[model samples]
Target: MEDEHEAIDRLSTRIDEKLSSFSTVSLPMCFKVPNLLRQTNEKAYEPQIISIGPYHHGKDHLKGMEAHKIFYLNRLLQRRGETGVRKYVMALKVKEEKIRECYAEPLDHNIDGDALVEMMLLDGCFIIEIIREYQTWNLGELQERNGNFRNFNVESVVCDLLLVENQLPFFVLSELFHMTPEPNQENDEHEATDHLSIWIDHEKLSSFSTVSSSGCSIFRVPNLLRQTNEKAYEPHIISIGPYHHGKDHLKGMEVHKMHYLKRLLQRRGETSAHRYLMALKDEEKKIRECYAEPLNPKFDGDALAKMMILDGCFIIELIRENQTETQKIDVDFRNFNRFSLKRDLLLVENQLPFFVLTKLFQMTGGPNQENVQGFIPLALLFFSRVMPGYGNGLVIRDQNIKNLLGLVLDSWVPSLKARDNYRKISKEYGGWNFKYSATELHEAGIKFKKIDHEKIVIKPEIDEAGNEVIKMGNEKSFFDIKFENDVLWIPTIKMYAYTDSILRNFIVHEQCHNNDTRYVTDYVTFMDCLINTSKDVELLRHSGIIVNNGLGDDEVVATVFNKLCDSIVFSKKSFYSEIFIKVKGYREKKWNLWMANLKHNYFNTPWALISVLAAVSLLILAAVQTIYSHLSYYKR
Candidate 1:
């Protein structure tokens, strides 16, 4: 009838007293309950004795006592309120204060849950309650109270703390803890982390997965912090070795220590083993949440990235296994978040060994080479996530790469073949680029013509307002625009057309200059160069926003256009028309001067130079002809 804590503490003290009789069982306090060894046959507590190994205990009786003690302690903590009843929780709060002092700076969000759990595991119920209350108190409606959001970290800390205790079965707790908040801010943006729920060893993952694992996957890390420090390990590998009997054995599997870790610290000016331990303690207390978890099923891409940074090999292995397993299950890629994986691909693509990358590229489905190539945007963002300034290991910008993708998709694939795919893709409601929409005819003295043997042609029609209209057929259709050197690449009607109009207009206006001399296709090199230039502009814009919000005129124009585009895409036809009108007005105002200059400059210098050279040659020939004529007259 008494609480579990009261009963366990009494039993524990009796065991501790008895354990003292054996010298081999030194450090009895290091374990939870000292009584596990009191009896040879521990059938009563046998269910709890998943593992029993001696660190210093050599005597058989002492070893048995150590196991018994740990068994009781593990049981005590497993039930939430047991430790609190024993008054150990009060001491835990004091210990937590000591733990806090270990870190130089206020702990970042990463360490909150882990720290709380570690403190709880060491201290007991009162301390756990205090931490929980502290978190809860911090969560009041007031701005000040809301400022330090501690409650969110509590579950994770508790979960992780329990995990590092390494008392629970691996897959059991692994499945028990893998959950996250919504990954992306909005549904439209394909965010990677939107609440990860991981499945491992065929077990269901739980919420607050952060507390349930010892290390996080690299993908779960924020883009900015993944590279700031290097002391952290990527907990990527999980040994599924000879003793694959149960979760306990698997959970306690040793993480292969980095051989260079000591050397790294020493080189970084850590003088002694004590100093190294101090730094590690600080990292564990402040950066790690009492404990951390390895990448698991519920880990969002950001967590996955973090795990990768800690241990790229482990995350990649899991990814390979998961992808294979998921494929076997025929799971849709759309169902689970894919963005979390983007960072991993980027991290391992360059940092890991070549064999790893080769193996990753070898994964079935999607042309390995093309998938690797088209996934540059995903890669660039990922490296930026792991290490922001870590360039894509190449000079290419995202836009340039996109253009390059366009060219590759174009030059390598014939238009006829692409058109076929494009036509087929147009019919679907959501697959690929197909979206269901009603088409209307435009009228401006033009007609919509369906060439029997050719692609659909736009012939204009005069609407009631005498405006131009183009009518699409009764069937829903989408144009299959390959990433080729065509209108598809020009930011027109597909992809991000309206938002990128300024950019598109710039490309076209620049192309007009080249077009005066040669056909548009003939001057592909010129288009390529402009595409590169525009990409630089976009990068500069993004960089400006990142460093300092610079509300320049161009930025204003771009933002307004983006807003208008968003409205058009999300709003009804009436709203789209109004937005389109504003867009046209803005486009006209923005490009009037640039367009005029483009026209004036188009045929001016190059054409003038050619004309002058021709004139000079003609003059020289005329003079020679006159001289010959005069010489002939003199001879006559």
Candidate 2:
């Protein structure tokens, strides 16, 4: 007991010592130079004396000015009438997370938050002093203290301050700037901000620009996306659109595509494909523009019209065959690997516009049958089997359906609320986060629970006298994640062979598609960040968050998620940001960390728990023996 108490005392003293050293340089608040600055002043923007923000920070040539920044900071503190560094640091420290988020890249975690906040304080004050003294070179204190301020080329420093790399966040500087009093200097500060805002707002405005549908929503998969799992994007049994229209490896499915198209004409009681051909020619330009990339130059208007008509008719007929057994085509879609075709249809590169398929369906269908249901619901009916949630009431009206991948995504998101929560980009640049794998979080006292995949159903019913009734079943979305009371409730994900491919393509679509809604990407990225290795995979598997359905070992599942995010850009502010902040708060409590260590190191293992019990029994026996000896001595 004496040894343990002494060790704790030493630790407490060490922590106090570290806290006293908080006023030092640390993390950078930086982003790339905005293109607006590059275009107008490309040749003229380099930091002459020192870097202000994170962009040009840590350059070898700029190290000499570090002493000068401190030199200016010291003078500013005296002028502001501040006694110590604690108050300024405390002020900025309260906003440390928000301050770090104002930059584009994620900051390194090596520096403690207190130290980073201290750096901001130093930089903010340094800017005010250097700029103030640059114009009025007769700083009475500086003239007396040192010759360094006199040696500085004030004009060069002023020009350097205007560069985008030299730009500090306005709010950060403003917080420190207003702490001190200066006669008529508010006008000068406002003027300087006005100039910076002209460049700052230019970039901000572009990021928040209104999202609109560019008729060309379908994109050719970039090589960066294909690196994860190449076969997933490539159609094994068939090709659908212009991007994969004529690859030799996919030629076997060509005969099957034509057979289905011929069967469709037979069902329509038409001997000629002339009407479909003419219809396709009329809409060739529209169809051509629907693909984001240009078609093969060899495919002029006639070739494109033929390909569009054939591909469009093939998909309509294929879905028709899948949707109904009664309206059967003579060719056997059942004998082939139907799963391969379904997987191929979900690929981002292999897609036809919903309109093209709709047009072909309307032309080929009997008016009575076609009028019964719109193309959107019919399409959803087929894809719902693969994705599993669109048949529910949450799907919006489908006039806006872009393609197959979009339809599949609509099915994945369970509710309008989940969609809105993900799409809500914060106006404040404040969603920077830390990645904590499943094992790491488990050791930090977070409990993981698998959300029941049952649909929570409620109904108002008259039962004998009259009462309301509620019901539920096993059917919920994988994206409905909840975190509360240090318990994370996530829906179980079933991993199949096609799971990796489909997820990668979905991520790519979200990256390139319109409306800035990357709900699918965000969810996958969150899961990837949690599963760092097979150990994390095993922890999550035991908790029922990940279910491997014959997808090799746990390591394979872990590798799938870890590599899924390669070369993919993630939004700085995302759906899980608040959850991350809450989890950090929970883990930061010292009691939680100590308790977690105790529970994991002792109670979780049988031999360790037994050893702990033995040690505790010895301590209790020693105390009782000492008490008896004292009582006997007193009685005597």
Best TM-score goes to which candidate?
A: 2
The residue-by-residue lDDT of candidate 2 on 147-262, one tens digit each, is 44332334445567787667777888888877654643322222323322333234322222211123567876654455456776788777888888788978877787778778
- What residue runs in model 2 are displaced by over 4 Å at the alpha carbon? 1-214, 325-331, 368-373, 388-393, 419-432, 454-476, 599-610, 624-636
Candidates' lDDT values, in order? 0.28, 0.66
lDDT of 1 by residue, 559-578 (tens): 43333211001101121122
Stretches of model 1 off by over 4 angstroms after superposition:
1-418, 421-498, 501-611, 614-635
- Give RMSD to native, each candidate: 30.6, 20.8
Query: Model 1: how far is 505 from its true place, Å?
Result: 20
Query: What is candidate 1's TM-score against the reference?
Result: 0.18
Worst 10 residues of 1 by lDDT: 436-445
Worst 10 residues of 2 by lDDT: 204-213
